[model samples]
Target: MSEDASLPLFPLRTVLVPGAALGLRVFEPRYLDMVRECGRRGTGFGISLILDGEESGTPATPAGVGTAAVIEDFDVGADGILALRVRGTRRFHVRRTRVRDNGLIVADVDWCADDPDVDLQPEHALLGVVLRKILERIDGGDQAFPEPHFDNAAWVGWRLAELLPLEQTDRQLLLQEDDPDERLAMLLRLVDIED
Candidate 1:
């Protein structure tokens, strides 16, 4: 782990993985300011799953591992809330956190390495096929996702982990695993794909 750097933290109930897209409706004044600053600076904020507390009033306790979220699209909703589409760019491990006077949670975090590409093995063929089918269903007769790398083990694993109907804790565990192979193997087990 590298030395920690401070990042604005958004502790939500969901976990985000690198390359995944998340839509957020911003209503709170503190987060609205954070979003404005992030957009102005063209920088991302950190998203960590909330360990305790709610998203509305008080600052929540965030989990250790988190993902960096880059704003991809922004608009003002009819209700006058800020609606933003953000993509997960990278992973980080929170070292420590503190609450700012304005109620935004800032954290000192160490960035995690991106998953290395690995060639898909024959044993993992079923997992790849399942992932492709899921994407197709989500796309609804059109390819909404970018060109997929079913032949890449790391990509396949990340996509599967993202699309699977797994618990937040389970997804968080997969995100924290540093090894792509181990992550895929764990997914296989979670999906009850026996060797």
Candidate 2:
């Protein structure tokens, strides 16, 4: 997150949580160019949930707090579409924003400290079980979630927050929260994962 204080901004429709995997289809010219630039520079871009406007044609308003996504894999299809796979690395707070002529937005953002890994206490064991079940159900098996961190409160909460079908606003709220235990509470109340 320190290589460049100013990372390219992408106001996306979905919120990217730290340690979560997300796949995006790049079709818009601005985004296509963004992928190329990020690839060439070997730098990641910022992803914020769009607060207003559309994903294309207009420079949508974005949430001030966002996640820095490091590109993991990419491919170009026969239709000239760029398929991007990314992993959220860290959370950031936007200091300023500006749009390019091509409608790309770049921002000066400060990286947020990662949540300290806290052992998942016994009270929250149900949450861990739910996350494990969801991960196991995905067709990719372990590939869907990679290495699971059932003992870490932050990792369990983030995985559930991403895998569950909760509203984007709720997920964005979880992303902005600084406390892993608090985030876990919110997810437990939202999904009622407890029996």
Candidate 3:
């Protein structure tokens, strides 16, 4: 992840957690241009959850923290639209934003530190099992976790956050959290409450 710098922001209605996969359709001209530029540069774009406004026509309010995403695949959809499959790589904090003449929002952001490599504690092991079962039930469930890291605390928590039916705001809070054990603890409470 780069240090403090500027990045192109794509504001959406949902939150994107690290180590997860998301699909997007590019019909907006501004975003289309961004996609072309990223592809040309072999670089990724930043995705922030829309805090206000819609996904088109104008610049929308975006969350302060978001995930950096890289395009994994793209194809023409049945409607002849460009469909993109992106994977979240890292988290970043938006220092500020600017709107280009074309209506694209670019943010000056600082990359968050990588999650510490903490082993999954025994108490949190059930979360991993639950994640596995949920993924098994969903179609293409393994797409978000191409390689499993069930023993890693942060990995399990992030995968669960992506797969769970938590509210977008709740997921955003999880993304903002800096401690993996704390995040996992919160997930445990959320899972219990959801149950």
Candidate 4:
């Protein structure tokens, strides 16, 4: 992990993983300012899972680990709301956080390193097949995935983590894990597949 750096935080009830795409509707003034600044600088903002409180009202307790989200697309909705499509870029560990006057949470975070690439093994073949099937069912299918590395352990693990019907906390745990192999193993245990 790198040395701690400051980032604007957005806490939600969901967990986002690197390489995942998420759509958000922004109305809060603090968040609108965050979006504008990030757009102006071509930078990203941090998204952490809310451990307590609510997404709309006051500042919430956030999970320690978070993903940095880069805006991929933006538009003004018919209702005059800002709608944004953001993709997760990297993972970070929050060292500490402070609430701004407008109720936005800013954090000092250390960037988490990407795990070394590992080839999928025979034991994990079932996971790869299932992931393929799942992707095929998505709206854009393979086109949406774009060059997915089903043979790579980390990529496979992240794809499964994002697609699985797991609870937010469960997904958050997977996102926090640094070891790709261990993450895959844990996913295997959580998913029950029969012949």
Residues 1-195 of candidate 1: C-alpha lDDT, one tens digit per residue:
245677899999999898888999999988998998887887889999988999879999999999999999989989998899998888999988889899999998999877887888887888998997888788452444667788988888888888899999999999899988788888988999766
Residue-wise C-alpha lDDT for candidate 2, range 1-195, written one tens digit per residue: 474399788888899999888998889988888888888998889899999998878899999999999999989889888888999989999999988999899998888887997999887889998888887788995977677789999999888888899999999999999999989888888987665
Stretches > 4 Å off in candidate 4: none
Q: lDDT: which is higher, 1 or 2?
A: 2
> In candidate 4, what are the lDDT values of residues 114-195, reduced to their tens digit?
7788998778888899999999889987787889899999999999998989888889989999988878877887887624
How does each model score on TM-score?
Answer: 0.94, 0.93, 0.94, 0.95
Residue 146, candidate 2: alpha-carbon lDDT:
70
Pick the winner on lDDT between candidates 2 and 3: 3
Q: How displaced is residue 144 in candidate 2, in Å?
A: 2.8
Task: For residues 143-173, write the lDDT of model 3, one tens digit per residue.
Answer: 7457888899999999889989999999999
Clash pairs for candidate 2: none
Q: Alpha carbon lDDT of residue 7, candidate 1?
A: 87
Better of 3 and 4 by lDDT: 3
RMSD of 2: 1.7
lDDT of each: 0.87, 0.88, 0.91, 0.90
After superposition, the stretches of candidate 1 with alpha carbons farther than 4 Å from their true spots are 1-4, 140-142
